[model samples]
Target: MKKRAIQILLALSLIFYKSTWFWRVFNHLAKPYLPASREFFQILLLMESGVLFLAVIY
Candidate 1:
């Protein structure tokens, strides 16, 4: 359990780091083809972060 939590924590930090530049570029490239997916992507990140939070907190 502790190992899993540590993994999630690391993933959360990686996501936080890449989200700014990497996600922006990726989203911009995909925007023309799938405008609505942007919201989905944001929600996906939100959920992932939430799960990671729970894993790290407890």
Candidate 2:
């Protein structure tokens, strides 16, 4: 049972690591089309903050 649990954990970790790596490569390739403006990041931050605040309140 311990060996099985370890195997499952390793499998999940591998999947997550690979998916993250793939997305990083994809993001790098798509970076040119993505917004690079400071205003864009600021807006994203404000949006996330508002969402989190609302979540906590409600």
The models' CA-based lDDT, in order, is 0.78, 0.60
| TM-score attained by model 1 | 0.59
lDDT per residue, candidate 1, 1-58, as tens digits? 8888677778778769866776889777997798878888888878877876776766
Please report the candidate that would top lDDT against the real structure.
1
Q: After superposition, how far is residue 46 of candidate 1 from its true place, in Å?
A: 0.2
- Candidate 1 — worst ten consecutive residues by lDDT sum? 49-58
Across residues 1-58, which tens digit of lDDT does each residue of candidate 2 receive? 7876666666556655755665577567767876565356556655755654455444
lDDT of 2 at 26: 59
Q: Which pairs of residues collide in model 1?
A: none
Q: Specify the poorest-scoring 10-residue window by lDDT in model 2.
A: 49-58
